[model samples]
Target: MPPASHDGDRDDDDGGSFIDMESFYASSGVSFVMVLLTIASVLYINPYWRRVWFYYVRITITSCYYFVVDHLPVPVKYKVLELRV
Candidate 1:
């Protein structure tokens, strides 16, 4: 039998080079879930880690409070003072 002639058209072959989007999304979702699960497990199993997380959260809240209090405009501060009184 004679060999088939080569052509530039690629319509016959399935798309092997392209990434499967469904599989990619499924794997990404699974990875995200796993990471969250791991974090939750660690926080649940370790009291020290949980305490550290809370400490950071407390510090963040305190810093934000100070920033807002110190940087408020004069009129806003007066209004707050009026509300306080």
Candidate 2:
């Protein structure tokens, strides 16, 4: 008697599946390396950008503080300023 065939099993004559996935794998690998290089270059070259970013952050915080305090009553504003110091 002949053996029964399974639906999920691969046929011996079929081409390998890796051929279909090769381009997808290669593209993803290249994009991953590019992203890594971009991050490393940013961190290693002209790190002064970090200082500039910090300055902008400080200015933003100061502006937000002023915006909040500008609306408060004078007495509360003074108390808040005193607490900050």
Query: How close is every model to the real structure, measured as TM-score?
Result: 0.52, 0.34
Worst 10 residues of 1 by lDDT: 76-85
How many angstroms is residue 7 displaced in model 1 relative to the true structure, after the best TM-score fit? 11
In terms of lDDT, which candidate is strongest? 1
lDDT of 1 at 56: 96
In candidate 2, list every pair of residues with a backbone clash.
Answer: none
User: lDDT for each of the candidates?
Assistant: 0.86, 0.77
Clashing pairs in 1: none
What is the lDDT, from 0 to 100, of the residue 50 in candidate 1?
96
Off by over 4 Å in 1: 1-17, 64-85
Q: Across residues 1-85, which tens digit of lDDT does each residue of candidate 2 receive?
A: 9899766675553354645566788999999999999866785776798677668889999999999888766775456443554
Q: What is the lDDT of residue 27 in candidate 1?
A: 99
lDDT by residue for model 1 over 15-84, one digit each (tens)? 6647777788999999999999999999999999999999999999999999999997666545744355
